[model samples]
Target: MKQWNIGVYFSLRFQEIAGALDSALAVPILVPVQSSHSDENSQDLTLKQSVTLLESLRSCWSEDVLLISCADKFLRLSLQLLSRYSNWLSSGLADWKKGSVSSNPGCEWAISALPDDFIIHDINWLAKRICGDYLEGILQLLSTCSTEVLDLVKKSILHGGKSLSDLLPSVINTIIEALVDKSVEDLRQLKGITATYRMTNKPLPVRHSPYVAGILRPLKIAGCSRWRTSNNIFDRRC
Candidate 1:
């Protein structure tokens, strides 16, 4: 089996779409923050650099989905690092305040505050900055993935269990339904071609049944389109 770097694939796909768009906005490349477990000092430095990059890109905010993608790849590393940094700032401010009284207290206080001159490092603010529209650009990106990559995603979801489903938008169910319908249509076409080839003793064109089957099997296994339907029956008797 081949290993796929889903994070890189997702970022590249997002960039490709952003480039084709008419707007001047570009998707910002969010580098995942490193964990503090390995080299705390270096991790802190990298975290600061990531923060600086985000600040620079704030003016051209395209979608918070990009940040969500980063969080998905990095898991709790990004959140934990940011939270620790914020606490560090608060503790440092307290120490500074106890040690010396600045001649200009207002300026000093404003400079020391977390949200005053920087992104609020809390989870809620981070969510606002990273998931503002709530999976707006995500579906677009997911639709563009190649069938092979989609298969890999399906496997990952299965191995990781259903909890991963919460990370996906409800709109994905509709997309899956469309995919299954298309696959069924393709299979029908392939069957017709196979029948024609058998009768005429001519070689059939390359069959895409396998590819379509590969795509649909995982979707069915994952229950991507499991929804209930109801038919209304009304009768009036006077």
Candidate 2:
């Protein structure tokens, strides 16, 4: 009888698992769901399988396994899978407070089970992956992320192994976009609440006096003017 090599067995099994994930994640980007019924169905099936496999892998994770030489492959695969399924995971997160069931329960479970170090690694990988071609989509994704994720992304960009000079333009664009989005959101919320008060014939909360608003208006305008001038300069540089 031949003796079994336990080490070889585990190595082969790990490779098989990683290969399965690689195949699942190889699905090509299809046309918009509205444009191609068959492609949409195929994409959905691929994502479902990927999410299922991800949860299975998460269940098997341990400190010992994570220390293995092949673990980086698993980590890269996990990050790619997470990025693809981020929308599903984020939607699930919003339902946590309401005790509502998630649409993608497996994704929610897998994401919640990920270690903090893994999360940080994933964020760093994503930061390094961003490029001019994918800047808009990546920024949109990051903008909707939690503060913890955002902070990690910033740290990765500023302190990670990349050259700062090469990333300056992308960094500038990201900051401008984030600032603009935040300002717009704040203004929208303020206008919405004030409008609601007007509709209900209720007096608005008196946090700031009318004199304060008068003083702030010119300052706000000046800030906007400065931003516009800077934006013009950015456009010229680009």
Candidate 3:
């Protein structure tokens, strides 16, 4: 029989959510937080509030109930938006797996470092830079990069594969510039239709669904035959 550890799994989910939420809050508020005269005090207050909320949330739900409910919600969402949400889900799952696989103290350190405002600021900065010819370059990079290179970038950014402490300052600045450029109006208008058309033509692959990828591939492998490997689902196995 398959074994389950409800408490351990719930602790993991809470940690994952906490990290993501912290990241989401970090970005937009970073400049404001930094510029504040009482930056340290403000940061401490915000963190305390967040921790209190999370503690309250955990107290309200039993581990099994919370886990099952979240699973059901995700499954329902997946069924509704399989084509679009599949890639997102896979990426998130991959991040969680990466988080779990690293050394315990290292993992905790990574999670602790991923404060909410910081990630939000980074994404916001990225959005601003993704414009004009610069955006075209990024999309071109994204489109033309080898699968291995793309995988590496994904791991480096999303999976904590390297020392982001030293790397983040430069990468965040550059990515923000690239992303913001994309958000500009005239340039956006120029590319919007083409982008939509291209996206329609070459959709993002769902890493959690190999069958989906195989179906989308233009040609089949000759020797692979009718035999299909059932390795796409990115659930607990990952």
**Count of clashes, each model:** 1, 0, 31
Taking the tens digit of each residue's C-alpha lDDT, what string does model 3 give over 86-155?
2222333233335442322212322232222333333333323222222343234355557775555344
Q: Give the Å shift of residue 162 in candidate 1.
A: 27
Give stretches of model 1 more than 4 Å off.
1-73, 100-128, 131-238
Tell me the tens digit of each residue's lDDT in model 2 across 59-170. 2244444433433344454444444444333433344333454554333433332111222222333344432322333234446667785566444433322332333343
**Model 3 segments more than 4 A misplaced:** 1-30, 34-162, 165-238
In model 2, pairs of residues that clash are none
> Which residue window of length 10 is worst by lDDT in model 3?
227-236
Tens digits of lDDT, candidate 1, 1-238? 0376666755574454332321211112212343432433223222233344233223122354344334344223323333333333343344343544334222233233221111122222333434433223333445566777555544443332222223233224333444565467646656665577678977656655455666566456445322110011011110
Please list the C-alpha lDDT of all candidates, in the order they appear.
Answer: 0.36, 0.41, 0.34
Candidate 1 worst ten-residue window by lDDT: 229-238
* Model 1: lDDT of residue 158: 33
What is candidate 1's CA lDDT for residue 43? 30
